[model samples]
Target: MKHYVLVHGGCHGAWCWYKVKPILEHSGHRVTVLDLTASGVNVSRVEDIQTLEDYAKPLLEVLESFGSDDKVILVAHSLGGIPAALAADMFPSKISVAVFVTSFMPDTTNPPSYVFEKLIGSITEEERMDLELGSYGTSEHPLMTAFLGPNYLKNMYLLSPIEDYELAKMLMRVAPAITSNLTGTKSLTEQGYGSISRVYIVCGEDKGISVDFQRWMIENSPVKEVMEINDADHMPMFSKPHELCDRLLKIADKYA
Candidate 1:
């Protein structure tokens, strides 16, 4: 049996993996879901998070808890990619494979933050304005984080079934703004993270991170394999949990 450590995206916590975790556990593989500091159920407040390192504390702590002989498959989604990549670099021997689920696969020349900035810049001005108006509002400001309101959240994340959309509307939280502004830290090295197996799972209907952008990331940082869930939105864990879990199992069988 394989050990899978799942990381949630921005504004998300370990709670997001509710569906897939059970499926994986039922299949006899171990599952560990992480909520990065301040994003999920973690007690750390967003106002107290000062640096990117502080935000990554949960992932780092999880890695530290593992024994030397233990290795895990790191599954990351959305903004979780940044910390996952950093963790793979810092503790390559502990990670058997790194999976990017509709997430950025950053390179040394351009880290995940740079890729995120570019993703934001790639959107049309009209679309950007719409997103800002819909998801980000002044009343939710000053904490350096923003939340997606129901409408925006539905359109971007929960394009699956009606029930899934309703569930997300009740659960999503405020995501940090500074996750993409970090600088000066060393980037991934070929001898370190690059040596570990990498995989990318693309969510075809993802409006938040487009299919084209997913392909671009693969082009920049080649992976051992690529998997796709055609009907999924950005939150495939909620939208297409069965398919996502199946794909994860396949990857684990192949690489982990």
Candidate 2:
């Protein structure tokens, strides 16, 4: 059995992987679904957490439990890519593969926000205004300004075909302003990425992240695996957990 660390994106928590966790465990693999500080049910008041380093602690602690050859497959979604990349670099030999699930492929110095501007469309003045450092306090992260609207079916089809309206509703929250921390990706690239292999999962119908943007991301990312999901959305774990789990299991099999 192989060990997997599943990281959730902005506005999400370890709870995001609830549906997929069981499938992996039943298949006889070990999985740890982590909730970064201030996300999921774990978040209390905003004041409870102050920085990204604080959010990354639990994952690092988990890494300490293993030896150099213990390979951990890190799967991150959306904004979660930032930290997962850093963690992979931190415990180089311990991490075999880092998977981005509709997420950014980041280097050390790149701010998760910086990648967003490059891969997705250019930042609008209004959007820039909303996500500006002042908008969300240096202490808080901002959630998505806009989402796939309520065409209901059509909306989910393109971006997050994983979630239904009700489930999608609970999954959202105000992300912290710590996105500014992503400015460090350049330094990360300077250092070797170490022993990790990267896999990029691109969802074809994702209107929120967009195929063009996703392609830009793939080209710039360090990894080579680009798995396309036919009609999935941003939150494929919500829309198609079963299929996602099956694919993830296959990836795990290769490493195990």
Best by TM-score: 1
- The TM-scores, one per candidate, come to 0.89, 0.79
Q: Which stretches of candidate 1 lie over 4 Å from their true place?
A: 129-144, 178-180, 183-185
lDDT of 2 at 173: 57
Count clashing pairs, candidate 2: 22
Query: Where is model 2 more than 4 Å wrong at Cα?
Result: 44-51, 108-113, 119-164, 181-186, 190-195
lDDT of 2 by residue, 193-241 (tens): 5356778888776754667877787776556577877667877887778
lDDT score, residue 160, model 1?
73
lDDT of 1 by residue, 70-146 (tens): 99999999888877887888789999999999996778766546777678668786555434322222442322465
